[model samples]
Target: MTTILIKQVSWQQHQPELQALRQQVFVVEQKVPAELEWQADDEDAYHWLAYGPQQQVLGCARLLKTGTLGRMAIAKTARGQNIGLRLLQAAMDFAQQQLGLAEVHLSAQTHALGFYQKAGFVSEGAEYHEAGIPHIHMRKKLSPQPQLGISNGKFFVSQHKNTVLTMAQQCRRQLRILDYNLNPAVFDNQALVDAVSALARRHRNSSIKLLLIDSQAVIKRGHGLLKLQRKLSSSIAIKQLSDDTGVSDNLVLADDCGVIVQSLVNPETIWADFNNKPVAQSKIDHFEILWGQANANNDFRLLDL
Candidate 1:
């Protein structure tokens, strides 16, 4: 077996080799037009190349600062050797570790959806033509590294009401949210609404479980999350806590890896967000226990009100 090595190289360091490999795979082999294969964004992206034991470039991919992964191509001879997966993993690592990005997105050719899907990416949107080939947008959220202490993890503090949405974008498998009133000001924003919808679309097998003290506000506001729950009813679920449950903290847990906890419902209240696995898991376990006893909100008509 030939040992394959993957490296992050600058455009100045491996432009010729990267361009040659992309041309061979995207242009010649896949029949993509040369004009569409090359783009100005390539100038600023971080490129990863896979090299075989003999130092031959087997594949290459690039990561843009905006969390877009593009120009991924594996050599014809290197197909079925797991080089593409290695390259993608490298790009994702750089994006999360170096760029501090919460998620990575890509426009995958429809035929390659399964390949990426196996590596944890979720496909979204309708299939569309790109460079005369069918393509779909895909995304994968980066899981935060486990931290033993609060001082060692990435921390976020915000009075901005969209903090929940920011936390949602970092979720990969599960999103457990506990809030009072299922606040419309927080869940009804267009951006957060779209993020939830995208999350449901991408992670069809995952779940977003919501526990709220009251649903009247969400129902009265015609919130997007409610609409999304109706459309993707299986992937998302809602429950209402009894008035005496004594749940005062607003919490958001992402995949048992990251968490955001707000002590009160006031927008001005200070909140803490971090990527501590143990802490997040403890909260998730507590939430599940409470959820088990919570009452399901099956009234769809309230969402329409």
Candidate 2:
């Protein structure tokens, strides 16, 4: 089996490799005009490359600051291996976690519409010609808004653990989490860990404050977020509730824009709001008061293996 690795690269650092892959896939194989393939916007866009076992470039893609995903190409030999999917996912991750964008847009070739659709992209407009190739406007909404509410507000009820984690990734400036025992099942998800790690790495002034009533379960199971808190001590902090104040509601707040609140007694029933400011702010203020009363926890260190 061949191992394939996908990573982000700078235009200046991996110019030759990116150019070679694009030339082979786009210019020669697809017969796209040279002048049209190599656009001036390449310099300003963020680029990514997918490499095979021997470090050979198999695919490439770029993301614009305005959330446009374009110039995606996969080598002929790598077509059936899902390299394009990885490249597209990398672009979407960059747009959300690193750039803090709400959604991603792409001009997908009409024939490849099915491919993008599998990745959650929906066609927005009629097909048109771009550089002699049929193209259509497509977009993928990155943030999940609440499912129910009025014109200015909406509410979401998440029954599964992944839904709550997905909401946490949309957090940009600040994140406040409250739960009982800080259950490893919820905080140990790899995707959620990566999202939080990327957020801390991209935003220097961002804060992630976690408050748990009991951390015995998490400590026994080895939580990834605990390890992350230790590594990013300045940005992430873990605390234990010193009193019984505000322990009934398990919540996650993202800045002043979004919030997820579940009853600690009934974890399955979760209520979240992505657009309502007043509701989110109320939860945030309650969190701050509880946070102030919480005590710093230093027991998250690695245990003997």
Candidate 3:
């Protein structure tokens, strides 16, 4: 088996090497115009070069700042050696772990769709021609993401119920949730209640604050989450937003990292980011403002755990 090592190199340092591989695959063999093949983005992209055991460049690729992968080329001499796969994997690993990218996008040649698909990229839209070649746009999510575009009218509750459970399981020292009535399907379920219960007991100083607009729904419908707050009130406290505050969004913050935001009563837009600290912190700050004026739910005394 041929051994190949991939390295992240600068365009200036390895211009000749990078140019050689891309030129062989794109301009010479594939006949992509020389003017179109060499791009200004080449100097700015995250470039990767694969080397053989003999120290020859085997393949090369570049990842743009906007998370687009392009200029991927494997020398004809190195075809079928898995160098392309290795080069692509290294680029994606850097984008996710090192660069903190949420996803990566690429344009795949029509004949190479299967190659990118095997690497977890999904094709989207109709086939289009690029650079006089049949090509299609593809995308692959690299980091943890919330499938937040749930718009099903009748099955909406079940769609994102798992999202709540996921964010809860990822919580560390703090979890803040602001909801109107603790949407029964999403938060009142036993699985989520148990997860939050475990979170409260796992970290001693962990603060789990739930801000609700009303507790009447849980009182009438008998929610397991209501039972949880009653038993773990010391670690997990529930509060009610002041009626006059007029907040109308469902927001959940998990340890200042994960966030879920949705419009309440008129929930047309729902979004979540599991690895965004800045966005989560911003929402938590807003939650704190509401929590400061919020009062503890005295109604929990109505239920005995």
- In model 1, which residue pairs have backbone atoms overlapping below 3 Å? none
Which one wins by TM-score: 1 or 3? 3
lDDT of 2 at 232: 91
Candidate 1 residue-wise lDDT, 232-260, digit = tens: 88889988877736565788787766777
Q: Estimate, for each residue in 1-305, the C-alpha lDDT of model 2 and write its tens digit.
A: 56766678899888898889888878898889999888888888999888887988899999999999988988888889877887887677667656889999999999899999998999987889987899999999885333322224443342335545766676777888888866666667788889888878878899888888876667777787888887898999889886566578888887777777777665544566666778888888888888888887666664223
Sorted by TM-score (best first), the order is: 2, 3, 1
TM-score, every prediction: 0.49, 0.51, 0.50
Q: Between candidates 1 and 2, which one is better according to TM-score?
A: 2
**How does residue 112 of candidate 2 score in lDDT?**
98
Q: Model 2 scores what on Cα lDDT?
A: 0.78
The lDDT, on a scale of 0 to 1, for candidate 3 is 0.78
The global C-alpha lDDT for each of the candidates, from Candidate 1 onward, is: 0.77, 0.78, 0.78
Which scores better on lDDT, 1 or 2?
A: 2
Model 3, stretches more than 4 Å misplaced?
Answer: 1-158, 244-246
Query: What lDDT is reached at residue 41 by model 1?
Result: 88
